[model samples]
Target: MGIITGGTRQGHEPELTGVVIRSSAGHLLVAVDGTIWRCQMRGRLKRGKRQSQTVAVVGDRVRIGAQDPHAEPPRGVLEEVLPRTNRISRMAARRTGGHVEQVLMANLDQVVAVQSIAEPRPQTGFVDRLLVAAERFGVAGVLVLNKADLPEPADQKTMWDYFVSMGYKVLRTSAETGQGGPQLADLLKDRVSLLIGASGVGKSSLLNLVEPGLRLRVGEVTGKTGLGRHTTTSTELFPLAGGGFIADSPGIRGFDPWAIAPRDVRDYFPDFAEPQQACRFRTCLHRDEPVCGVKEAVAKGRIPRWRLAAYLSLLGDLEERAERLGPRKRP
Candidate 1:
């Protein structure tokens, strides 16, 4: 069958439209009308001065040129990437100098930040960073404490409640016992979601439980380091039987949101908004600033101290990065 039919013509060549389901090593797997096409991007798309951002990523809708008729499996060239609704991105770890925005996925409806209840312990800082990035990118954020069957510390339960109180959907799930599977499945039923967390947090295991047919490989947390091993090496979108799709990505050790200025960081932390309004300076970052409403809230136990610490940690990173790279124009 033809790669795609009834598409708009571009200069007499019919252009097919598809969603990029998988992208790696400069190649993309575009899904067109239930068919998967192994495609390469047109040279022009990458020839410009757009080196800082990812050109295409999973969940991106793109228009591709006609496929070679004789090719055994469908193959095509991605001619253009359509505008994305939203995307989750982070500063790529660069061994050289400048920063590169790594778009984890495009057009996501929500991002599920998964963390285990025990084993490897919780990385609240990482979860905060992920949720902040989601907030900045206009994607809904969900916090999942996986391995719920394991004993959970009282403080962790308190933290979960705090996130819920802040208007976040927090789910306690255990893949081993099938707990919260239905709730998670319902949440993911018809939404384009991305599951992200540090290694060994059971992202794959949860996927396996929710969608058993996937049989995604699961890894164990190393006893020596108390860290989970990387199981999912690359990002790929999987269609759900119920509806919609979910993208599984490799676990990240750290997350630094791309192009976010230190001053703009507070905007992503909603809990700080109310308290920040009472600050002496409108531009106060709530760190070492006198008469700061946020500091006062923390002191009065109105806001959790850990939340401010997380905000300060991310703000400090962005400020340090700005010092090295200078001011960045907002996108």
Candidate 2:
């Protein structure tokens, strides 16, 4: 029902509060009470000078005007977006002029970075990058190794031990056998967590198993490329039966965190932060530097060599991005 206003003044109309459940190019579905209203954002929200590609993403709280009662499914006008506590984003592919931030999901308390032990094979680099992005965005990161029903690879146990030693929560899940569903549910309960991974990693399958009502479409890995087909086209949030909300995002092919300075990359990697303090130079990047504590740790087998390589790979990417985009101005 539309709120009747006595006068034409803007303050006369009553506003309704809701949370955004899904967003596309120009429209969004906001859930208020039990009704889902399709809304169009105000011009001001879209016209402001900003770096983010989208004005509002799923999990964003917003205030909307009353909806037309007679409209088929009901529609409302978006007025204002409430402040977000935290969000996960990446630097969008470079354009002709500059780079823009692609906000994936907003207001997430934790991010579950999913990877498979088989089928599509594990991409450690991708997993490492996602965790770093989560750390940079101020959201807790959890590593989930799915498809545990299959035979465990030789290096899988070692990889698990490495992450566990670094103080990260790691879970081995098997959607087919229900191996780690309870633990996964416990971690996700009462928290706003987002699922992120490459295609064919069983993100949809895992969600279906955890929350049976969600019949999310699951895709298989392409036989030729050994890559996953895009099953999720857009971001959507689902309320778990027990408590909390889970947002499932489309599988990402590449992820580069936004606004990362080359010199500050080490901070995003938690394991590197402490060892870096003991380095010979105050500005040591742990690469090509003499008397490096990080290097010594790697040599002594404290830190996995693959992990160091992942960090260096990300460092190179950040440096190249910085060169292309120039120094970032404080916001």
Candidate 3:
């Protein structure tokens, strides 16, 4: 889509273009110049067929009609949404049936998967899914192990090392003592990054440490559930003092990747790339397949067994989803 500058369109009132900093309940907070305008999407934009479940999300560039001078709190209409360079998305259940693509963030430079060392414990399954999604969407992925002040289990340490060996940058951070704060800050500096993880993983706390001025509200894990309480109700972008912007989203309990076919699941698992090539069958899912290189690597200790387990779990989910949805029709 071509850029739409602030000017008259076919003799109608002039329009203003800006980046969408936050979106909720069909309302968008667009940053036009230095001011933020509260706007609603145009009817036409909502009526058209869309690839993502959300019409517009945080980090989307949009065009809005000029705000009315007499409007009480400054409101406008979002006339058009600019094409996104890229988007990170997941599968969301549709009320009617099946699943839909839910875009988490658009035009992001990287995706940071945050997990804590202890307290609530780390869910490597969640981290793996995020990393796979990042790979599928063509975005850089960083894994942050928060709560560095706490003691880490031997197995966790081994997994961390394995992640590094797989070519993923893993940083150990502590929101309390500022451990690895500088490295995290440097990674997020001058870039549009999206922070995602389960609740109580210290996503907000780490951001507060990186940029104290933010003063974002922090939540604690429930004593009974040992899960983080939802602190961030909506996704919003905050400008960093060091340059660029960071988006803090509501904590996710689970992640289901969207639009990934069962056969294509192996492509997202980078560790399987080298090993799967040696499989007897070119179309190997790496599960129950004879002479699978991936399985052989696991047996030989070349690849971690946990990684294969995670891949099989995700593959099963995709296979089930595809079966329920039936064969996808070619457009």
Per-residue lDDT tens digits for candidate 3, residues 151-265, read 9999999998998998999999999999999999999999999999889999999999999999999999999988999899989998899988999999997887876787998
lDDT of candidate 2 over 183-266, digit per residue (tens): 999999999899999999999999998999999999998999998999899999888998988999998877788767778888
- What would the TM-scores of all predictions be? 0.94, 0.93, 0.94
lDDT leaderboard ranking: 1, 3, 2
lDDT of 1 by residue, 1-331 (tens): 1135456565655678889998886699888888788898888888867645568899998888766734756788888888989999988885523366889999889999999998889986898898889989899999999999999999989888999999999999999999999999999998999999989999999999889999999999999999999989988999999997989999988898876788899999998889899999998999998999999999999898898999999998888777777556333
Residue 174, candidate 3: Cα error in Å is 0.9
| RMSD, one per candidate, in order | 2.3, 3.2, 2.3
